[model samples]
Target: MKLFKSNEWQRVKKSKAMVIALAVIALIPSLYAVIFLSSLWDTYGHVSNLPVAVVNQDQTATVNGKTENLGQNLTTSLVNGQDWKFTQVSEKTARSGLKSGKYYMTVTIPSDFTKSSGTLLGKSPKTPTIDIQQNGGRSFFAEKITDAAAEKLKNKVSQSLQKVYLENLLKGTKTSQDGFTKAAKGVSQLGTALGKVQTGAGQLQTGTMTLQTGATTLSNGLLQYTGAMGKLTNGSANLVTGNTQLAASLQKIGTGISQGQAANAANISKLNAGFDKVNQGLQQLSQMQVTIDQSQLNSSAASVSSGLSSVDQNVTAVLADPTVQEKMKTDPAFAQQVSDLKSNLTATEKSSQDLKTSSAALNTAVMQQISGLKTQLTTLSTQAITLNNSAKTAIQQLNDSLSQVANVLATQAAPGATNLAQGATTLTNGLGQLNGQSQTLNGGATALSTGTSQLVAAENQLTMALQATQNGSDQLAQSLANGAVKLSVVHTGTKNVQALTNPVKNKSTSLSTIANNGTGMAPYMMSVGLFVGMISFSTAFDFITLGKKPKSGMHWWAEKQTVMATVWSAQAVIMTGLLVLVDSMAPKHILMTFVVALVTAFAFNQFVTMVIVALGKMGSALLLVFMVLQLSASAGTYPIELSNSFFQVIHPFMPMTYSVDAFRQVISIGGLAINDLLVLLALGLVSMVLTWLMYHRKLQADTVLFPKTAEK
Candidate 1:
């Protein structure tokens, strides 16, 4: 204490510029630090909701209001005081309006909405439903807002349905309104009448089919019989023609045989005449022979005898001579002489012999020929007789056959004609009976198969119509029930949507205690400015501006910080705990309040030390510069925005900015800026190093080191 008193007090008493500069420099960083911790007011914990539009398509009621009544009424009741806003619009505009970015989502009711609405409880109702669509995914907060609104609408519609159903149930209809019931009864009666008609039509159809079948079968049989009869008639005609032709051929053959027999008999007569002529010729020849014999009886006989002798002699001579063995060769002249004479005798003898031989051979040949001719004639005669007999027999047989055929034809034709007449009569009677039945069949079957099919269609259509009526009535009753439920259940919850509000100010004088303490930390920025100025002042006084070294107060102040620490530490600890004791604390964390104050003090101290080390002995003049330039711009009390660029340059590097952030976290939120704790600890370690190097060097040659400080 005494060393500090003597060294520090003596230096300060002597160095006037050092004293003035020290005062100014020390004020800058301290003041800067004071202003910094002040600002940082709002941004705490506040959550919000979205706005929605509702559209109604129901047109059952009449109203003159601007908003669609059904949707507006429903939204107002369900969403009041909750964190949501609901508005009503027409169905046509609602969907497009939702896409228009003004609202988060939209709900729309469809037309035929009551019919749609009535389906919640009805049998076989494909209900009319509301559309609650959102642009955002269901996971988004906006979708939650939309869903909340949608649920409200669902409840409303459900209530409406219940209400309608209850009213209908309470007020029952006097008559049965079931359309199917009445339709069924009517169908039953109509079906009974149609049943009789169906049976009658069936019978008529069966009878008509039978008659047609029988007529076709009979017609086919008749045609076959007619063809058979035609073939039989042709065969009979061919047989009669064949018989006549056979008779003609037989007559012709008989005539030819008769002519042949007659010719053969004529030829035999001619032969007998020829034989008679031959006998006469024989007689004349004999007579001629006798006469000739008488005429040349002696001469001719003698010459012939003589010539015969000569011829016999010559013949003997010729026979004896080997060369002339023939008689003619030796007696040619003699032969010539006796030739005439011997010729006549020879001619007569030859004639007689020839006649005798010829007669004998002729008798034999004639006898044989006559016998063969007689046999041929007899055969021809027999053949002619047989031909005549055959012709007669054939004619007789043909006549008999023709008579029999005629009788058989008459017999067969009579029965056929009788039967044909009877058949025609029976057919006429049967056709008459058939005609009667056909008339009965045609009586009632107005049409046939198609008529029955049309009747079945009518029955089916009747059934469908009846079912539809029952369904409609049930739906109307169900609609009443749904409406009642929505009305009763929707009156309970508050609206869940609201608007964003203005940001709050942080201050020591603020109505909010936590907010005020946060404001108290603002002085630390000015303190930080002062802390910088003090370093300049302390360094300049002891180092640069001081002329004397041994007894200068600057030199004393540099070495004995324990005294300063005593004062600063006391100031810091007291200032830090000051707000906690003074006010009814905000319902925030107590640890946060202590933390704000502690960081503010720590930052202020670190800045002082850093400047004190950086400025050294000449820090007095530099301190004066730092005070005017940096302190005014420190933004401790007011913003440093008005200060020059040089001041702005160094403002962020100052510890006050971060210290202020830490303070804000504590006061505004309810905790410390634990994330920035590292920076503060780092600043503390660095300040010690700067002090050791700069202060020790300044202490060695205070006057020489800061020459200008010695001059001043």
Candidate 2:
């Protein structure tokens, strides 16, 4: 084993080509790790260097009286973003650049972008669209990166637009608040007016009730006056009849005087007796006339007329009342009642006037007739006494006096009584008409009273409703005022709007954080480097050439392992140091990172050595194939699950997969994975055992085939 190890170095030192090859081989893994990891160290970080065209075809628009240029704003934000190298250009230039691969992607703001954004406040709002055209043929990763950039741009534009929309909405809210404040004030005034109306309604109800009472009293008085007029009519008829009887008696007396003056000295006694009967009749007629004169019908009629006038005045006043007039306009039933009452009162007033005039005329005529009759009856009585005392002396004088009395009675008393009776009848007829209307009047008054009571009830209900309405109006006004005040308290500034637009902020807390893409990729790239380095070492060094014959296959395996371990250890140290010092990879545990690197390198070297030792020169090609397979199978670039089914199926079998996992645990924020180290150690041990077995089998085969070389 010692001889084989010494000869291996002697062969490498003797050949200048081998010495240079060994030196190059020692750096292969470091070079591969640095080159590959550096290329993608911060791939996304440098995405800003990729050219992206921004076409600003959008025009400005007005949103709630404010000019908005969302397209221009988006362009400015995109230019400032770290996602892509955004350049503002025309649509034609952007398209040209996109087609010619001058730009990796093109972002186009549509002409109606701002216009569509302004529609958010409208009933049928339209969603604004941004056109992102990517040249997928340029580079798959570049296309994907630009796609992500486009998504970020879309989100940024959405946020900015949401902020603008919120600002406009807040402005509209402020205007609405002001309008509500004014409306509340108006409602407050309306409530106040409703209160006044309620008070006026109460007053109207009171007046209506009072008018009803007066109407009832006037109706009752009219009925009483009508009865009084009927009695006066009867008395007037009696006066007419008495006047006729007296006129006939006076005529008979006048004829008796003319006949008795011619024939009676013997009939003087009988003439005296007849004169006594005439005197008794005259006295009864005088008393009847006095009674008629004392009736005072004119006064009662004037009183009734006055009452009617009062009722008319009261009704006029009620109709003139503004509240009643207004109610009359609205209530057809009440209006009709009032109109009927007014017409009836007007007719009743005319009847009362006519009755008053007739009563005065009848009273005067009866008084004149009574005075004449009393005078004529007293004269006749005195003449009858004188004729009785001196029958022959003054019978002709007495007869002449009686004739004068009869003539006065016939001419004045009878005609006056007849005229009074006629006047009384007319008055009674008028009163009867008035009395006939009295029931109607009483009914109307009662109806008016009922209607007034109903009106009062309705007014009470209306007042209650108005009061409730006023209260509701007050509450509404108060609520609106409060709402306006609350709205006023809301802020709608740029900062507030921005906060409202993006209400939730992402606060991520990474459990295992890697500094950069390079750091994250360190484990995979380093695993790949170690495997490639092992393959390169296997190709450069002579694995099958032995300087001396070995006693056992174990000795042969030990000799190769010692040489490869030295070289692989050197490669691991150099690669790990460069990853730290040159590449600035900050692993969580630097020592653990180095240990994982050494273990990974050793595992790869053992695997390569196993393949080379077992397959000879063909094993080098197979080692390359093995490395290629492991590269794909290892969860290096992406998770093994993200890879194809072949890779996922082979993932657990690949030694590099564990190596990468161990490296990642040490390189990032976690402790080194014990399972990964054990798996890697187990794979290396297995490869070493397999290689030993292969060497043992080959030695036995050589010994059987060429016993002399085996013995040497």
Question: How many clashes does each candidate structure show, in the order listed?
Answer: 78, 0
Considering only N, C-alpha and C atoms within 3 Å, which residue pairs clash in candidate 2?
A: none
For residue 408, give model 1's deviation from the true position in Å: 48
**What TM-score would candidate 1 get against the native?**
0.30
* Candidate 2's TM-score: 0.68
Q: Tell me the spans in candidate 1 whose CA falls farther than 4 Å from its real position.
A: 1-4, 10-654, 661-686, 698-712
lDDT of 1: 0.42
Please tell me which predicted candidate would have the highest TM-score against the true structure. 2
Runs in model 2 with CA error above 4 Å?
A: 1-5, 11-14, 67-69, 76-83, 233-490, 703-712
